[model samples]
Target chain A: MNGTPEGTPERTVRVVIVDDHAIFRSGLKADLDARIDVVGEAGTVDQAIAVIAEARPEVVLLDVHLPGGLGGGGREVISGSATLLGSTSFLALSVSDAAEDVVAVIRAGARGYVTKTISGAEISDAVMRVADGDAVFSPRLAGFVLDAFGTAPADIADDELDRLSARELEVMRLIARGYSYKEVAKELFISIKTVETHVSAVLRKLQLSSRHELTKWAAERRLL
Target chain B: MTTALQRPPLVRSSDRMIAGVCAGLADHLGWPVKYVRLGMVLASFAGGAGVAFYAWLWTMVPTADESARRNARRPASPIAPAVSLPAPVVREAPRGPLPLGPLPDGGAPPFAVPAPAVAAWFRTRRIQYGKEILLGAGLLLVAAILIARQFGVDVPLGTLIPAAAILGGAAIAWMQLDETRRAGLVDKTKADQAGGWVRLAAGLALVVAGVLVMVSGSGSWEQTWLALLASVAVLGGVALVLLPWGLKFWKDLETERAGRVRETERAEIAAHLHDSVLQTLALIQRRAGSEQDVVRLARAQERELRIWLYRDAAKDAGLLADRIKAAAAEVEDTHGHAVDVVTVGDAAMTERHEALVQAAREAMLNAARHGGGTVSVYLESSDAGSEIFIKDRGPGFDPDAVPEDRLGVRESIIGRMKRHGGTAVIASSPDGTEVRLGLKAADTAEARIGEEKP
Candidate 1:
């Protein structure tokens, strides 16, 4: 839950908060726990990508609307950092709960989505979840994702779900349904390392940045 | 005579209705004011020709005091006593049916028409009257010859008739020319019922004469049909002259009516806004501590304004649901509660729809206040009706336990639905509480009837 494996020391979760508003960034930095290190901050899509790549933070709190760089907003920041996707996971912290915004960022590889009205503690928890490879969304945003990616998988022939091997699909469904990696490995009679490999492959094939987005993607399509 | 001719006409403001145009015309033409006004009213009924002429004359004439001021401003030339005086003296002249005294000095009113312009006008009038007289004499001679033939009198009709017609036409032409030439030197007097009255009476007489001609011609129908036809044609020509004025008046009246209707509608909207939205805004201003309360008031005002501006757009179910979700989001943010809004199917956005959303919002607020955990909202709509359910997973209370002063439930939720002819049913137990608000399509009929009552 704290982004550390069992038997390991409690390590700080390195985070980079990306938002256009300076006051919000400062307030959020002030509010978070000392255990969570604030590595860098960025006000635009290009700055976000550059800062995330340079800092190599474990979690990036990205806003949906940014000033510059491709004009694709948070989606651009996420897609622009394809090389850093394996290491740095993104949790969208935006003021918009618009369905299109939530779905677009998720489809472009953000780990989760939350509105700006969320309490500092809730945002900190979401950051830890994204760092620990879990999909976290504000309550209503999950419905938006679910509605965007229709419930029935019958219309998902060209969907990322169709590209995964059956074994990977099995691991995806269990993980998306909130099972830990060890639990998923145990369910499938595979070693933890093999499960991790399959998860990474599924993430790559689906263009997902982390296990969190993989879960959200699978959950939205109701694969769970 | 020269002094009398120098005086200008005045637009008699005392005896006037709607601009003094008729009175002005009467004073300028040396006619009795009452007869001129009556003639204008009759002409208005006959396609409004008199109204047009009166409006023209109104602009052309000067008011009594205005002419007097102008005369005083000018240097006094050597003129007789009457012309230099103001209009009150002229108005005091004897109110006879005929224009009294030497044609009022036989010159045009200086303000109404310049001396050179009057001379030209008289010249044209003389030519027109001469032609009319010549035509009249020709028609008379023709009629005389026809009557003779009808009476079986075989007199030498051709030479006698042609000679008499020429001589009479020449004599009439000579008299009109001489009068017009004299009118240039002096103010030409007008009869009591000149201008508009003469035109109106002429039109009426022509119509009556046509009817008589038709009735008399019925006996020797074939032989005398031309006279009847000529009279009818003249009546039609007169009617054509009045048609444009009547059409113009009709158009003006229609535009005025439309403008009045628009004004009334605007006033109604202003009153409604003042009564409801403005009052709520004022109350919110007084109680400005809570941001949530302010937000709620602002959202209510926004919804009202949007409905007023884009009523058609507000009627779309999708847009309505979006608005409700937006309101729910604001509540969740302000209260720090998790609200899950799930909508199934579409319902038209009516006043009933608005009522249901408001009731649902109140229910959410109640649950957030009295209960715990996530607040869940479920909206199910079908052709029959729409049902909204707000649920909270927490300890519940009895409805009767609510205090008498708590009007949130009594007015905002339950009363709202009842007003819209819908139902709000709340069920609660120790584990959880759910407020079910149902609005049937049939209830819209009742709501409409309620609207009609006020």
Candidate 2:
């Protein structure tokens, strides 16, 4: 009991699926049924906001593109349901590997992102981690973050908040190489908790650096 | 999706001499406004049928602004109903718009005025050489008729009116059919303009001579009415015979346009498939574990699909980034390991750029063959030059451990870069090997502008 809590004592995590494809949502629900309780589902921005508000699931798997609402896609769903952010978490699930799309949802306050190609087990794992207040960074997202924060071997960054410490970059690189958190800890000769801390630090930089390069990236892509 | 857009609606034009009916008809039929106005005046002198037709058209057609508003309000594409989010919506097959009934000539106008202002003025005043000559001729004809009447040779107005109506109607119908036939023929500039004027003059002369003959050899009112009704029935029979052929022609044009649109839609679908399915396959290859054959098959399929989808771009694959990808794809095929290429910007291919690509290729081959894990190739090209990093995650080997003859890392990668006036840095530790290849541009001014603290 005194040890660190492991994800709310193994209770099944409640989740909502938000995708335009009904077949994909049903398939994903069947795959995650053992660990994840499918509380509700929605297909568009308005429906996603309504369903998430009503169910208040622990985690919501959101598609990056959806019809309805000012054409903002998943980012609109997140912002439209801002009040639920304190209780529920959002994880962007998309087929798009576009950097602007990934960064836009993250900036709009998604806990993490995972591509649709991820195995059901991996996605369930990501959902559980997000439910436990941990940020999930897929390999592609890590690469995008590295590129945005300028991996040019410069310690002093142009923007103060956008700077990644030497240790954070190492953690990000290992993650980008498809290392699990446990594997990253072993590779870096650090504890699993320390690996989490470094990843969290990188994530903070990713969110904070929004005003600098990431915002410019989204603007140049006409995402704004 | 409507013939409303294809066939310009018979709206009253903004350019007006009186009611703008003639101007709008001129625009719709692709004819000169002055000629259309003259035809309307001649028809009016015959029986006032022109006034009646103009009123019917003005009441029937919508204005341009109303049509624009209606089009704007039409929903572009139907949005899937959200009530059935748990089940996919079944959509009905799209129906093609039907071709409408034939109207005036579809040919482009011959005398396309170069400027709008000048064209408007010409339409209203028509103060050119032809107008003056027509006015003088009209005055001479009136004087001759008046002198004849004074000499006791009366012109029969009653028979003349009926004959003029029939002749004028026939002339307009013939001119419309002639214009349609001419539209199907080859387009000629100077010849078409001259021929158009000649045809108009001939048609008018024929109508006027026929009316005069009917007046001089006057017939009773009942016989004139019977002849008009007979001509109408004959023209109706002719139209019924040609209706099917005209419908077939328009249908062919619509099918061709629809086919072009379908082709573009197909290209978009292919791009979408590449983004989703190809990416999914790449991810599967990364985690396929014991199913090496499955992973290799998926990788090969993905490579083929990507190349096929971007075949047009591959024709001019001279960018440094494209060359690196071609090399990475080669390594992936031969060594059965995945190579993920992420490029920032592209530069034109140069001889030194070829060295970079070759060195990068050697580094990738070493990583795939020896490293035994997925290789990551990152290329960044700026104004100054290009920088490529080929990194792998397998257990690294010391450079000194390799024998003299097996000098792929030292000779093929590092040596190749050195000979090409570029620098290659090999950093191998217990974690992995990272080969950084940098090629500086020869332009000093650009290099200075792109200078940054290394």
Candidate 3:
């Protein structure tokens, strides 16, 4: 739950910023310093992995494009820090709204994705959510997921692993249509916890599908 | 047959020997340069006719570059215009909303060359001779001919007859040069066609003349037959020597064509970027004082460009998705709100769906006016029906609280859908409002069949 007593200063989310732009990192660190603890910062993939490893931050804010590490960028950082993935959650922060890069890092184990244009307070909220073990889906990411999984219920029985449950589909659609988790809960007549559970379940199915249909879908569309 | 009237404009070639007169003549008449030079030298002895003609050609012929520039207006045919970049994604400064779709890349065939290899066989340069080397050979040949004439070393009639036959045969084979070159370029002007006919006829006349002289002047028919056979054999030998050169020429043409395609693609991409992204960046910079305006401009441009890039994949998305996108865009532009549209599957816009689109547009307009931030529009067209969800993160308002005159939601969205045999559901709470428009398959036969299946 995001609700916590204001008196507990130790409840600040430990975070690492991974972006190639130093100015962006500094600006973000300054903006997020009030609510989030900026434990480490890195500008490249190798640096990101090293800093994340050293800091053992609760959440890593990663840029989709990085200067190093086999040219896979944020995906490489997430995979490289696979050991820390169990204890440390990774959240993708990018300026690109491209589906390919977003899907790539998500497939590589990013807990959530938020665009760079997001406000500092909003990004802090996303960080806290990821730190709380919840999958944060932006409207665009929700739309991408809906497109990849396909929203039609007719063929749901054929592809068990790739299909989204009816409830999950409803949740994803609401999110895609720019509904916040709290709003989605209110609209669906469910609790905020239930909304988070549905999103987490969808995220699990996205990662667990044998054939990453998301990547294939994006590739087929030449989004890659 | 060899009429000089209406001849192609004689141009001095850059690839030349001496004054390029002989090479120019060879090019126009489809004869070998060496043979034409030798013929001219021999004709010079006939009252200096060849020397006078060469001087005239040197004075009259335009240089290669001049000819090339002059021919700029000439139809460079056979190459269809480069695949036009999908007619600039017509973006209208959003009065309301903009339409979206991908332009199909398949526009025109890139090159019309029938077969580069085959065409190259006739066009390839079989001989590469230096200017100085050709000049030296010409001088030596002239000296030898003059010396022989002075010594009165009577050349045998037998040798002279065969030499004539050989020259005639060579001319006949050379006629293919211009014809094939025209074919290769695939831009045969009427003059070139007429010239080709004349060259063929002249070649035929020469061959006939050579045969008649050999038949009449020789002592025996066997000698004449033997001379003709030897001429044919020489032509075959020349062809054999040119085989590798033809192949090389073919390869060169292929490489050149590939390069042309790459250049075209690069130019198209650059033009698109300049028109869309660069222009948007300029607009953003000009309006930099307002952060909101800058963000709005960038976001709209980004969406338009992305849709254009993925136009191919979106091509089959049909009218439903495009209509919804346009609706979302209209709201965004008019209200300065961000609308995210994601579409899955597509179907034809049946009459019933018109109500669906209108309702969705109304919903989006409401959301933008009331919803403070980004609005999401998700459209899915499947076998059953098309479903559109227009959700907004705004302070929820009760449908009944609004005055009866505010017919936007009640009359436009809800009433419009109900009249068209569709359903509209509005879910509003403290969090936000979601307007779902569902239109069942009224006219789609496929959907009717799909419903029958289960």
Which candidate comes out best when scored by TM-score?
Answer: 3
- Report the C-alpha displacement of residue B229, candidate 2, in angstroms: 41
Q: How many backbone clashes does candidate 1 have?
A: 4
Question: How much does candidate 3 score in TM-score?
Answer: 0.63
Candidate 3 regions exceeding 4 Å error are: A1-10, A152-160, A211-215, B1-244, B313-318, B444-454
Segments of candidate 1 deviating more than 4 angstroms: A1-11, A146-224, B1-345, B350-362, B372-387, B391-395, B398-454
How does chain A of every candidate compare to the true chain A by TM-score? Answer: 0.66, 0.91, 0.92
- What candidate 2 keeps of the native contacts, as a fraction, is 0.00
Alpha-carbon lDDT, every model? 0.62, 0.69, 0.72
* Candidate maximizing DockQ: 3
State residue A49's C-alpha deviation in candidate 3, in Å.
2.7
Model 2 residue B21 lDDT score: 69
List the candidate numbers ranked by TM-score, top first: 3, 2, 1
Taking the tens digit of each residue's C-alpha lDDT, what string does model 1 give over A1-224? 11124222366799999999999999999987655789999998889888988999999989988989978999999989988989989888776534556667876888777777556766776677677776654444534432333322333455555345567646644443223456557669998667767755644444443335445644543321
| TM-score quality measure for candidate 2 | 0.50
Note the residue pairs that clash in candidate 3. Answer: B96-B330, B102-B311
- List where candidate 2 sits over 4 angstroms from the true fold: A1-14, A20-47, A67-72, A118-129, A132-134, A146-216, A219-224, B1-294, B300-317, B383-385, B421-434, B438-454
Better of 2 and 3 by TM-score: 3
